[model samples]
Target: MVRYAQTDETRPADCVIVLGAGTWEGEVSPVFAERLRHALDLYRSGLAPKIILTGGLDPRNTVTDAEAARRWVEAEGIPAQDVFMEEKSRYTHENFLYAGEIMAKEGWDDALVVSDPLHMKRAMLCARDFGVTAYSSPTPTSMYRSTGAKAKFLVRETGCMIVYGVWRLFGVRS
Candidate 1:
């Protein structure tokens, strides 16, 4: 996880994918905000021509993560035409599944996957599983900055990776 987080594969792609974290009452969490910031930087640098925001509704919130992120990026002056939304996924796998569908419709086969540094491995795996040629572009500043917080997330990510591996072995698609 540490090795993958330290790598940045930012490059021109069909689009920039901003993976969703949870939001509260339509306000993006700090983690999600950082992902957006990185994605925006990539967009501004001309790495990609479009941005795809992936996230669905949370039970505790009135709006989906995609909606909240779309609002935030639009407020940052991203035009509506350059922003796409995948608002039916509630997890990382589903995020790419749904985003893959969007990419198919749009004729996009590659993407710059944006998310927290620790989350890049799984995010890239999901993207590849869903048929996207994914390049990692992790957020520069992760919310899990402290040693303890980073360690905790690392453990959680290890477990998640194991579970995803098992699911892949079983041919689970979502």
Candidate 2:
């Protein structure tokens, strides 16, 4: 008999918020596409009944991350009514703050945060600061074993953790 680790009790939220990632010349990058794919999987797996695509238009680019994600998900057959877009945020902090407001207005208390695995820790902290009980659903990486990629992720995660710690200590709300 195989015994699996017990998973956390994750109740379905009114929405799942897919945080933005970089796009290459208006197209979704592989990392960004992975996040969207995870969000879709969450929906299909009954983790969340709805999804919120969060990001803003890059001044240099014509399309917003939210729009790109929405288009991709819709192409995958998710209904329009099941997707919400928060397209005014240009940073991770703004993504949580703006989306948190939307969730509150919609009477949602819980959310599944979909993002790169390396980002989920800080993202969850930011979401919690906004009064949302956020749970992370990291997008699985195909290159987790790459030494260079792992090093990059570690550096980024460490920097984010430091920033988040300072933000929380200073009573900063973002």
Per-model CA lDDT versus the true structure: 0.92, 0.79
Candidate 1 lDDT tens digits, 1-174: 778886789889989999998897789998899999999999999999999999999899999999999999999999999999999998899989999989999999799999988899898888888788889999988999899999999999999999999999998886
For model 2, what is the alpha-carbon lDDT of residue 40? 88
Q: How much does candidate 1 score in TM-score?
A: 0.97
lDDT of 2: 0.79
- TM-score versus the correct structure, for each prediction: 0.97, 0.87
Task: Tally clashes: model 1.
Answer: 0
Tens-digit lDDT track of model 2 for 1-174: 001111223457777899998677878778788888878888998989989999999998889998888888889999999999999998787898899888878888889888766677677768877777887777665334588886787787788779778888998765
Q: Give the TM-score of candidate 2.
A: 0.87
lDDT of 2 at 48: 92
Runs in model 2 deviating more than 4 A are: 1-10, 142-145
